[model samples]
Target: MALLRDMTLGQYIPGESFVHRLDPRTKIIVTMLLIILLFLVETFQGYGLIALFIGGLILLARLSPRFVLRGIRPMLVIILFTLVLHVFLSEGEIIGQLGPLKVTKEGLFKGGMMVTRLLLLIIGASLLTLTTSPIALTDGIEAILSPGKRFGLPAHELAMMMTIALRFIPTLLEEMDKITKAQMARGADFETGNIVQRAKSLLPLLVPLFVSAFRRADELAVAMEARCYRGGEGRTKMKQLLFTGRDYAVISLTLTFAVIVGSLF
Candidate 1:
């Protein structure tokens, strides 16, 4: 599927822009705050403001608009499904009807709101990963979770697990693509069928993909053990994270973004 290649999770784009230069921790925290703001955005005005905010950030990061938005393509089905569910299931003044289901104004409003929220969250996270390397993201997460160590939480381990999972998304997708192509080359029919037939055809694809994933996991575990890896106890970082004036500038910018959306929007 061409869609697999468009999935940009956990990948980084190298750049010399201000966004790429900001500390990973700063990006993580600011992105978290923006998500909180996204939830509170209820009005079309709010949506417009957020659109501008995300658009500006995308441009600032020197990212291609098409590339960044490409990740959303695969999610269209789920988005439409949610919209339809809301249209049929939610109650209010019925503005239209599709067979037995009634589409209400409130449902339309909510469906649009739900779409906006998902889009904002998706785009925001994509922007973060697009600008920050996976290693830097791991470091940022560990730093954020370090405070939980006082409560006996395995912060470093948790961060490492999260990082590994995020990092594997693209890798595993690529592996599946390769496997699919290989199978197709051998005359395995995947595209010439009805819905059920096509689904059955994918059974051959999934088995190899899962086997490859488990094998990779086993190899990773063995490699870690060979290096004498244990839990995150007594771990030391090579590069100590420090907040600088630029990081504070990020804070100011986030605050400005909030005010712009909340007040003017």
Candidate 2:
């Protein structure tokens, strides 16, 4: 699978790496801050620093260097489209010409900036999911959003839903793959139809997928009910997350980096 080869996002790899050891809440907070900084930055210098930040994280996480490259490679179309949009629409001094279009010096720089921001954001966000388990991620989200409960927000439910959706991605993909193979074995042509016909053919595939999803959901609900499951009102975590000296050390370093970058550019 392309995903198995490239995007490790949302797939937890077990290790004793420092990144794997940090509190999930710390990783979540750090990732959030990095994403905010990505959007707020505009200068090339700023992007350079961000690049270094994310690059360091990839190294620190002990993820494959191939992974960082692969993460960006599949998204090349999106980055190129973003660059092209900026090139045609941005107004500036005409530096050169591309066919019937004009290329502005500012547009090129802006395109570079846009592409860098998007790449970093994707890689950073993916790293969080890669290093943290779905359960840990859900707990972190609930903990961070717990204050919203006073405003009647369903923080715990939302967290559970999000984590479940992520956890289901690989499961659903495998299911679809199996279905496609079986259909092919039966001479169900999914590839020989015209665009519209192909679209129609997909109906057979989707019907089974939806049915499987619902069946699994029902099984999960019944299992939870059987175990006397309730809402988050007074639920106690079997493995309660706690911040240690390492967590504070990581947070302190993140704050320091944020301040330094903000001041520099």
Candidate 3:
């Protein structure tokens, strides 16, 4: 469950700096462009450039690398498990041989590459959310999806739901954490048990969490209706976002990076 919390999909740290000030739409576009560029990075030189670029963004965001790495700590076990599995299962000319296991240079090379890619992808995206707010990210998502509304898509409504959901993730996680602590206080033991017993202990934790989540949803629905919240029609933003020169510069630099990385292929 802690690993689930560490997924980093919707985790947003609050900030008011320049990166935080950019329109959500601009940030989403720029982030996606950078991620796409990452796939184009193959050679060590390309990876080095990508590292430098992301490092610069980290500095600009004023976020500690330690915090970013902390978000990835829970996944370290899975990463190592994967690397080990790939190294042993992959067939190649034997680099070393034990009693029943064989190791190959090719296997180690491929597994290492896979793990590195996973680390970079997670850390890179985490950097985006670490510097941006959930509201801003949702707003950006809605802005980017607005054009789809013309094709009979409920883009605004979808975005609104997503925004609200993202806004609640941390709150819900905190709630779950508290609930788990309460259950533990009542003699619910998650550790020191077999797999089945450990899983069963989760039941007590989950039941109250689900019931409370439902109650919250019902209350939110009632509140939304009380506010006469209709769909996207006749809605106006109190603080409409406008992109500036810096936004364009960021986008242009992202595009140039893409081109340079693409040339490496």
Using lDDT as the yardstick, the better of models 2 and 3 is 2
lDDT of 2 by residue, 1-265 (tens): 5746565566677767889889999999999888878777778898898888878887888988676566677677889999999987789999988797889988888888898889888888888987898889889989999999999999989987886787787799899999888888887888786899988888878999999999999998898779887877777878898999999998888888887787777
* Number of the top TM-score candidate: 2
Judging by TM-score, tell me the better candidate of 1 and 3: 3
TM-score of each: 0.81, 0.90, 0.87
TM-score of 3: 0.87
Error of model 3, residue 255, in angstroms: 0.9
Query: What value of lDDT does candidate 2 attain over all alpha carbons?
Result: 0.84
Candidate 1 Cα lDDT to native: 0.86
Q: Mark the regions of model 3 whose C-alpha exceeds 4 Å error after superposition.
A: 1-11, 170-187
Residue 112 displacement (Å), model 2: 0.6
Cα error, candidate 2, residue 244 (Å): 1.0
* Model 3 per-residue lDDT at 210: 92
| Candidate ordering by TM-score (highest first) | 2, 3, 1
State the displacement of the C-alpha of residue 235, model 2, in Å, after optimal TM-score superposition.
Answer: 1.3
